[model samples]
Structure formats: structure tokens, C-alpha cells
Target: MEQLSNNYGEFAHFPEKVIQFGEGNFMRGFVDWQLQQMNKQGLFNGSAVVVQPISQGLGKMLKEQDYLYTVILEGLLDGKTVNTSEIISTVNRVLNPYEEWQEYLALAEDENLEIILSNTTEAGIAYDESDALNDTPPKSFPAKLTALLYKRYQLQKPGFTIIPCELIDRNGEKLLAIIQQYAEHWDLKADFKTWLTKENTFCCSLVDRIVPGYPRDRADELNEKHGYIDNLMVKAEPFMLWVIEGPQKIKEILPLQEAGLNVIVTDDMTPYRERKVHLLNGPHTAMVPLARLAGLETVEEVMLDADFSVFVDDLFARELIPMLDLPEAELAAYAEQIKERFKNPFVRHELSSIALNSVSKFQARLLPILLRFYDTKNSLPLGITAALAALIVSYLQEAGNDDAEVLALFAEAKELPTTEQVAFLLAQTKLWGQDLTEVAPLVDTVNDLVQKIHEVGTRAVIKEIHQQAE
Candidate 1:
């Protein structure tokens, strides 16, 4: 079999217009895949120059394959299973800044470079006070970006449409702030700071896709199937969404929507963020404890069981969706998509993995909806309340994964009376951001649910909730 490379077939070369940080599976499968779609449609006639964000990366392997790889998308689409593969050639080259610092900095001088994309993980966006501007390639992603931005500023080049795909809230804004801090710390001048702020468009983006990179398990079979030894083949889910919180002008620049891609360029991404949190993530967090307690190992396992499936459906239709301010139909459609994603055959999403730090997950994903549902309907959302009860019970049973402090608190709470335990957990303002006990009937409702869960098994309680909803 031929190695997956440009040598095997002719490939089009476009002007380098995007400097992407992080040459990981996610960028290749998600951002670069979308870019390839746009380029094929003549909407975005450019390729990305991938800069390895860290010292150790896939730069050598990517370069070996001529920066070409295949992305296999397997998942349900529109109520039907769709499996597709396409060779992504949107990456022009991969540069390791550690080895080729000068060449990496030279990319900043490219007159055509207009977009900056990154997914350096959530921790990659932090400010490291130790980073110096003079370093060949600064340690942190933000610092490296700051150095590159300073280089571009020196050349008086047009600033980039900086869109960071980090999972943090306000990712672009936070990246910009970190760069500005570096500017202040390094004394890069007020004029440079002005250019950084005014010339550049920092777009906070929300990206969703599951890229289980490098299918090593089936590599030999897939290599023979494709007739190519693809070292960088990435396996991803068919569903993808990129919501860029930016000005409308960015739409004209990228034009991904013209290429029939799932890209949303909005001025505010709060509603979209809320939709994802409430619909997709909230349900995942809420299901983890109950599902794990019921001996379900994976998300698909929970979704496959008839009663648990209906319980999750009602949790969405009756509880989570009503709290959102977006169009009911749009929310409903997204909820259905999430359901399909949960049941993805290719993905084995473990309940215990999702259960990690579930305290914070519950606080962020479900608490707002729980509060809003109560305020709007003037009644407790039984499904969510039950989930909360299950969470506490899981911790009490020593089945939860959380910070040591939180685990210790739950350990101590386990010895208290049922009502007192409920009250004690609810009153931990530091954990919940506010005293949940103040909400009338909340503590009592949760106490009742916890007691009921202890009496009946987790599966029985879920069946009861679904029956009541029906």
C-alpha cells in the first residue's frame, strides 16, 4: 500500500492564510476539515500552516505524510447512520517552533495570513508570568501567540481574525487579555497594545466534535481498506458545530456557511453556549451518577435501556428545554442531536469518566436550569432534583470522583441524618456558588428524592420519574 502523501496524487496548493496552533487530532478533524470543505467550494481558497504549540508533538509525523491525512466520521446523522471518510489537505505544513523558530516567526510576516486558530487544551490559555518575549518560542500557548502577534505588529501586517477553540468560556477574550498582560509585562509599548486591541478581531468560539484520534486498534485493517498507510488518520463523530462569537464581517472573510458547513458567526454566543450546556452537557452530568449507580458503564448503555432512555428524554422535554430562552423548536432539534451523539456506536463514553468532578459539572451545567425551571414554573423540576439526589447518594456510597475536599465533605455528611445531610450539602455555598438551601421547598424536595432513591434502587427511581412524567 502507498503511504498517504501528496506524492500519491496531485494536490492543490493555496496561499497560506491561517496559522493554526496545535496540530492535534481535533484541529485536523474539525477546523481543518471545515477549511478543506470551504477550499473545495472556492469559498476559502487557502490552507493552514500548523505550528506545534509545544515542544513534543506530531510535527514530524505530519510532515512525513506531506501534512495529509484522512478523517473518518462515523455517527448518526438526521436519524440515519452515516460513515464517511475524506482526505484533508488543508494543512500546508507543520512547523515545530522548538526546532524552526525563525521559520515559525516568519509566518507572521505573510501578507495573506488573516486567521489564527487554536485548541491548545483548556490549560493552554493561561498566563505564565515566567514567559519572556525573548524566548525562541514562549512556553505557554498565549505567550507564543503574544510573541507571534508582536512580530506581526512589528511588520505592520493586517491583524488576524483570532478565533480560539479552547473549551473555556470567552476563550478569545481570555487569550487577548493574556497577550495584553504579556505586552504590559514585557513593555511592548502602548501603540502595540492599541494595535493588538483595534487591529485584531478576537472571536470567542465554541467548537463541538469528538475526535478519537489515530485509530490504532484498526490501523492495519483500515490501511489495507484505504490502500494507504495513513499515520495520522483521525476518527471523529459526524456531528460538528463551530459557533464563532464575532462581527458579521468575519462571515464574509471565512464564508464557511457558503460551503454548507455547520458554522455560526454570531455577535454573542451566550445563547448557543447555554443551549449546549443545558441540552447536551447538563444531561450528561445528570445521567452519570444515576447511570453508574444502576451499573450502566457507558452512555450508550444508559440510552439503550427503555426506561432510562425515556427518563433522559423527559429530563430534556420537561425539565432542561423549558428553562432555555432559545426557540423551542431549535432547542428540540439540538436535543435530538445530543441524543444521537450519546448513543454513537463508535464512541464508548464511560459513565465514570463523565462522573469526574461531577460536583462542578452539576453546578455549572444543571444548577442554572434547575433554578430557572423552578422560578418559571413555580415547581421543582423532579428529574433534575432526582439527579442531584443521586449525585449526593453516589458520593455517600463512595462511587463519585471529585476533589479530595468535596469527597471528604460528603464522607462526613454520610453520617448525618437524611434531612440534615441534604441541608448540609445544599448549604455549601462555596461549592454551589450560593446557598441552595435558601430556595424554599428545594431542600425538602431533594431530601425526599434522596430518601426515595435509598429505599428504591436508582433504576426503579428513574422508572418512577418516567412513569410520573408520562
Candidate 2:
């Protein structure tokens, strides 16, 4: 079969108006896919110039395919199985900043480059004090971005609509603050700092999609089906959402919504963020330890299990939905959507992968709801407490993946008596941001659940608690 490239068929080449960082599957499947739709519909006549954020990345592989690839979206939509594929031609080229540092910085001179998109992961947006402005591509993502923005400032080019898709809270604001710190550290003029503040529009965005990149298992079959070899083929679910918090004028800039895409350009995205974190991520975090203990490998497996599915449904409908401030009907609808997404057989979301840094995940995703549930109902949320117990037990068994300190703490806790171990884990102010033991009856309840889980196993405990709830 021929390699997937522009040589295979005629394709429109648009101006490189988007400078995107991170050329991973998520970007190609979500952002680039959306851009291709926009371009095809004549809403946006532009393509993205992808910058590989790290020294080693998919730059060479992407360039080999002429920056062209396919996105296969497969999942349940409205109770129907939908599988679709499209060749994405929205990527103009790939540039590795590590090798082409000068060329990377030169993109700042393009007046047509009005937007900047990034998904460098949560840790990608950090301030490295060691990074120097003169260094090739700098050391950190923020530093690289700072250097590029400085070049744009020098050229007096119109500032970009900088939208960061990093899964951090206030991502755009955090990124902008780091760039400001770099400006201060590098002794750039006050005027440049002012330009960074006034000229640039940083938007905090929330992106939701499950892009499992490069289907290695069925690569040969997919290649034959498409009549070409696509090294960068990404598999994702049919669902996609990009909620960008920016000024009203940004709608005129990107016009993503105008293209009939599932993009929401909002003035405030706090509610949307809450919806995703609590309804979607909260259950995901809560279920990982329990599901893994129940001998489940993937999310679909967990959803297929009779007991686990009911447990998940109860956790969402009974515990999580009531804690949210959104409309009850809307939250209920979203909960159903999340359940369907979890049941998607095409996406093999592993429990072990979600288990990483679960302590922090619980603290961020479920802890708030746990606290609110207790406050509102004056009783422990059984499912969340059960989940907490499972988390503690997972750590004790060394089944958790977390920071060295967290692991060490749990390792030490494992040597203590059961009650003391539970109490000790709960009292760690660093883990849950406060001594969770101090909450009335929380420690005793979690201890009971933890003991029950150990005696009966996760599935039995889940079944018992689910029956009690029903």
C-alpha cells in the first residue's frame, strides 16, 4: 500500500495561521480534526504548524507522512455504534524545537499566526528557573512560549489568542503568569512586559475527548482498509467538546462554533469545568481502585459487570449529581452521557493507567463532593467513603502509583494495626489538604469500609453497598 501523504490525492493547502505545541494524538484527533472540518466548510482557511514540545517526539514520523494522518472516531452515539475515519490535512508541517530552534522562533514573525494552541500535559506548564532566554528552545514549555512571544513582541506583530489545553486549572492564566516571571527574570523591558499583558489574549480552555493514538493492534488491518500506511492514525471516541473561556471577540477570531462544531466559546467556563471534573473525572478516579481490586482491566469491563455498573450508576446519580450546583436535569443527562462514554468498547481505558497519582486525583475530583455531601446530608456518602477506603487499601498493598513520598508513607502505614493505619492515612494533611480524620465519623466509617473490603473483596463490598443503597 502507498504511504498516507499529499501525493496520494489532491488536498487543499491553507496558510499556516495556527502555531500548535504538542503534535500528539489528542491534538491531531481533536484540534486538528476540528480545524479540518472548519477549513472544509470554508469557515477557516488555515492549518497548524506543529511544534514537538520535547527533544524526542513524533516529529520525524509526522513529517514522513507529509504531516497527514487519519483520525478514527469510534464509540456509541445516541445508543448506536458509530465508527468513522477521515484523513486530516490540517497540519502544514512538523518542527522539533530542539533541532530547529531558530526556525521555531521565526514563526513569531508570521502576522497571520493569530492563535496558539497547546496540550503539553499538566506538568508541561511550569517555571524552570534554570531556563535561559538564549538557550535553544529553552528548558520548559512556558520558557519556550515566553521566548516565542518575546520574538512576536519584537516584531510588533499582533498578539495571539493563546489558548492552552493543558488539564490544569486556570491554564491560560497560569501560563501567562509564568511568562511574566520569565520576563522579570530575564530583565526584559517594562514595555515588553506591558505588551505581554495588554497585547496577548490568554484563554483558559477545557477540552474533553478520549484520543488513544496509534492503533498498534490493528495497524495492518487499518492500513489495508484505508489502502495506505498511516503511522499517525489516532483512535478517539465520537464525543468531543472544547469549552474556551475568552472574550466575545474570540468568537470572531476562530469561529469554531460557526462551523457547527461542539465548541463553546464562553465568557465563563467555571460551570463547564465543574461539570466535567465532578461528573466525569470524579467517578473515574473513585472507580479505579475499586475496579482494579475487582479484577477489572478496562473501563468497559467495569461497566459491563452487573454489580460494578450499578455501583457506578448509584455513585453518579445518588452522590455526585446532588452535590453539583447545576440544574438537576442537566446533571442527570450528563451523568448518563458519562456512563455511555465509559461503556465504549472501542476505547480501552485501563484502570492501571487511571490509577497513577490517584491520591491527588481523589483529592481534586471527589474530595470536594465528599465534603459537600457530608455538609448537606450530615451523613457520610457511602460510595465515596467506600472509594476512599479502596484507595487507602490499594496504597497499603503497594498497588498504587504515586509520588515517592506518598508511596513511602503508605508503605510505613502498612506495618501498623488496621485502625491506626486508616487513622494515620487519614491524618496526613498533605495528602487530602487537611486531616480527613477530623471529619466527624469519617475515619470510623472509612475504617469499617476498609475492613469490610479486605474481608469480602471489592466486588462483594460493592455489591453489598449497592444493594443497601437501592
Candidate 3:
């Protein structure tokens, strides 16, 4: 018998009521997949209409499949390796506003639309001053949303709730405020603001899922067993979290908590938000650069590297762990879980993707550890600092095969006069948001280590950093 693309027949059908702004991996793997569980469990019956937020992307491809795509969830489930794929029929249509602008706006008048979910990346939620109300799609996500909300207000009162899944702090609330900024700038009517205030609700949400999308290389081998060519196959880490800061009414509307899934509906999801960013995401950013330079291709490889292995564990255990407010045991458990996640082996985390704005990433991830180390220990450890130094040198290099993609992505390296003046680049207030250079020993240490990276190869630097940590 011919194998099916995915196990689609097992899941139940639901009313298409959720308007998702992004037709991407995270939204499909995280939000739509979770809804499948809720729909299957008979708690919530809601499907989604995925909109292509950007002008370019998978909208055309998704439309070819009747908006039906396979989600292949891969990871350890209760100590057993479980990899499953099911065609998610929850998406009714994939609409591209750049082409189908009117139909995209028509969703605003959708009376049954209870949720406006989005994951348009970190920079997606911004103000584009020139974005006109009548543009095909506004310059920014918030502007487009503002226009849509205004359309909804004019149609009648509002019934939709917004749950932003963007990887930013207080995503829903931040996006809502940005929309309000658009409203104020454009001088939208008072009734619209009142409708925004009274009729509509923006619930701040924190979502966690490492969705390694479309195992392109492995799809053929994996398909031999399942018996179908599943091109839209998706993969994710075996964990998920959706923490929404909303009232009891939201609980009633979104019954995801009833499914025994990890859905936390609380008055404040701030702690959980901080917990995810500081613990899970922080390590990925901190490790990616140095690990990539050390000849490790994937996160799993980085975790398993004989030299960098202990260095990473020690870095997190000694430097990063103490910065967190959690108990030592709890922090250790989380760190161990992160290490295990890195060892997933299934997902291929490309170093170049994480290397975008890497200086910013280092500031966000490692700078906190550096500062806390000084405040508590009064001296920064050499190994972690050396990793940061290697990262900076990687970013600085103009010619190299490995870091070529990363270097290309950056807006031409214009700052800093010479390689010897690396510390001056680290001192940039625009990058770190504060003067991190003055934070004693860190500046000189990073500068010195960067010089060493310039002299010795990445492998040697990795060995030295590891030895220093030991």
C-alpha cells in the first residue's frame, strides 16, 4: 500500500476562526500544532487562516497544498525517541496581502475571528512613519494591524482577541502599544481607540518551541518508512510552552490548559518570559558563534565537542547560573536540559542564521553574565571571555569561507579603525545599550583574547579557553 504524506485523518476538524499574520515554521509548529491537540481533545475547535506578513515567502507553496502541510514533530518523549508527522488540515487558506490585499483586510470583518496571532520576527513590530493606510501592506506589522483594527471598528464593534507570539518581551502588549502609536500618529477616531480599549483585548504571551523546519536532506530517508514525499515536513524540540497574561475570560475562550499541555494563563507571565529568554534562548546565542568557529556545524556537535563541551557546561554552570534568581539545583536542571537539547542530533541549527547581529546577541546573552560575575566575583573568568573574543574576531574578518555568510549579512563593517582597537568596537553604546567597556577587566580581557584569536587558529583558541575554564 502507498504510504500517506502524514497521519491527517486522526485529527478533528475545527471552525476557521484564528487569523495568523505569519505563514512560517514557528507559527505552524508552535501555535497551529498546539491547536490541533486542543481540537482533537474537544476543548477548543478553532482553525487558522495564515497570512504572509512579508511580500515574499511560502504563501504560494502553501496554497498549492490546499493550505494543508505536514508537521513532523521529532524529539524524545518520556526517554523514547518519538518522531511523528501529521498533515495539519487546521489551516483553511494561505493569503498573501501583497497580492490579495482586500481579502486579507476582509478578515478584519470576520465576526467569528477571536484571535489575531503573529510571529513576524523580532524586528517585524516597528513603526514605519511613511506607511500609508491604503498601502498593499504597511511598512510595519503594527501599522498593518492598526489599519485592520480601524477597519474592524468601522465595520462594527470588535470581537477579536490578539495573542502575539513574536520572540520579544511582552509581545502582545508591546505590539498593541505600537498599534496605538500608529493610531495616535494617524489621528484615528476616538471611537476606534475606545473600541481598542473596551471591545478588543491584547493578551501578552510568551511562547517557547525550537521548530527546526523542513528536514530537506533527511526527508527522503524518513519518507521510505512513512511512504510519502512530505516536503513541508517540520521538526521541533520535544518541549512547548505558551504562557498568556490574560483574565479568566481568556481561559474560557482558549481552553488549551484543559488538554494537559503546557499552557499557563496567569495575571502576569513576566517570570516565565524571563525564565525562557534568560535560560533557554540565552545559551543558544552565547554558544553559537564560538562553537561555529570551533569547527562544530550544529548545536548537537557543539554540545558533543570534546574540548568545548566542558567549557560550555562550565560557562553556564559557573558564570550564567549564578545570575539567575532560581535555586542552584533548578538552574542546574535547566542547564542540563539545554545541554540535552543541544544534543538532539535531529535538528540542524546552522551557525550563520544565529550569527545575524551577533554582537547584539552576545550583549544580550553573555554581557549579563559578565556584569554579574564582576558584581559577585569581582573578576571575569578567562574562558568565557575568550569565547566572546573569538566571536568578535569572526565578525571582524572580511575574508573567510566559514564565516562568509555571516559577514555578508552584516551592514558593511564601518566602525573601528584597526584590529588592535577591538575593545573600542565593544564600547559602542548603540550595540550594548550601555558602556560595557568600562566594566573592569572585561574590556582588556576581551581585547587581549581577540588578539590571540587573530594570531592562533580557532581550534587552538577553543583548547586554550577550555583549559582556562578547567
Query: Which candidate wins on lDDT?
Result: 2
* Model 1, span 1-470: residue lDDT tens: 88899887888778888999989888999999998898888888999999998888998998899989999988886667878778999999888898898998898888889999998865577778889999987788999889988999999888889999876678899999999999999999788999998999999988878676777767898888888899999988888888999899988989988888888998889988888867887888889888887889878898999878988999999998888898999999989878879889876566776676788778878988888888888888888888999998888877465655678788778889766998998999756879999889998888888888889878898888877777
Flag regions of model 1 displaced more than 4 Å: 76-81, 98-103, 135-137, 210-218, 285-298, 346-470
TM-score of every candidate: 0.76, 0.85, 0.87
Q: How does candidate 3 fare on TM-score?
A: 0.87
- Estimate, for each residue in 308-418, the C-alpha lDDT of model 3 and write its tens digit: 677677777777777777778987887787777778877776665556556555655566667777888888855557767777667666433322323443324435455
Q: After best superposition, candidate 3 residue 229: deviation in angstroms? A: 2.0
The lDDT per prediction is 0.86, 0.88, 0.73
Clashing pairs in 2: none
Tens digits of lDDT, candidate 2, 123-222: 5777889999999979799999999999999988889899999776788999999999999999988989999979999999988887767777788999
Better of 1 and 3 by lDDT: 1
Error of 3 at 114 (Å): 1.2
Please rank every candidate by TM-score, starting with the best.
3, 2, 1
